[model samples]
Target: MEAEYLRHGVPLADYQLTKADHRRQREAVQVHEWVQRQLAEAPPWSDERWEEMRQLLGSPTPPWELQRWQLRLYCGHVIEATRNRNSPRPDGGVCDKKRCPDCGLDPAVIVAFEPLGPAAEPPAESHSLRSSRSTRQPPADRRSKAELVAENNALRAELEVLRDQA
Candidate 1:
């Protein structure tokens, strides 16, 4: 029975590995073809294209544009204050003073307060597949094990035919 699974003087395991390699090569070729199609369809790079790319790469809001107050604690530690947060005064009178993130023992003096800007937009794309997988709601496959095995066998036969043609 095991001898029947041999292909062209090759062991069943070796044959299976070759078939798997072919499948991987076919997938890589498909990805290259898709990229070629995209390049062919895409417009040539122009100033507008550069600007679009820049916007895509750029942060939605500049970091320096945020309402930030540089607070200098009497303990010589510098900390930043954001919007709606209590800022230390120069005279150490308004809000909570002597509240340092590092020391938390001395009066904090407001060094500089900048003009506030717009809120930052949420990121367009996730950094990684693993992180995005949690947000992706793919449909559940409820196929039976037998049905899946039958489909796999059919695909394998089809692949064999394709391989022979190639």
Candidate 2:
């Protein structure tokens, strides 16, 4: 089944897939390294921000669900694989078969994906201050994309200022 193939790679022989088919399938599920890098560099998730997102989605428990929504906010599809954590790919990455639940979106345009940093680490005073500032805003779901982007830019700027002050 296509779903099974996407969630967990099938043996080429079993599926009668050529190498090219496998390659194409892999590419379909691939998330570029830059996307991962950008996410890695983004600020960690603040407790309030995390809670807010949880509430927005009505608290989906599975990691993939939230991750899928996050990717949608950035790129309009689930570019990254998050399902089946215990089973990784042969290369030690996430299994591509576990990615994007079928919105059938093309890979995200790199330029379209914006990083909204949230604090994952223990907040420095400045970071806490930043969180306090964000707490005043309307909920994320209600905000326009432009507004969110602008706010993110402003937060990044504020963080730079705080870093310089330290």
Best by TM-score: 2
lDDT of 2 by residue, 1-166 (tens): 0121112222222333346545655464465555677899999999999989988989434442121112221123323333322222221243223233555434422111112222133337755776788778777569788989999999999999999999
The estimated TM-scores of all candidates read 0.22, 0.28
Give all candidates' CA lDDT scores: 0.48, 0.42
lDDT of 1 by residue, 21-90 (tens): 3454455456656878999999899999889999988865443233444444334455555433122222
Any idea what lDDT model 2 has? 0.42
Off by over 4 Å in 1: 1-66, 85-93, 96-98, 106-166
RMSD for each of the candidates: 28.0, 20.5
Find the 10 residues in a row with the least total lDDT in model 1: 1-10
Off by over 4 Å in 2: 1-13, 25-32, 59-96, 99-166
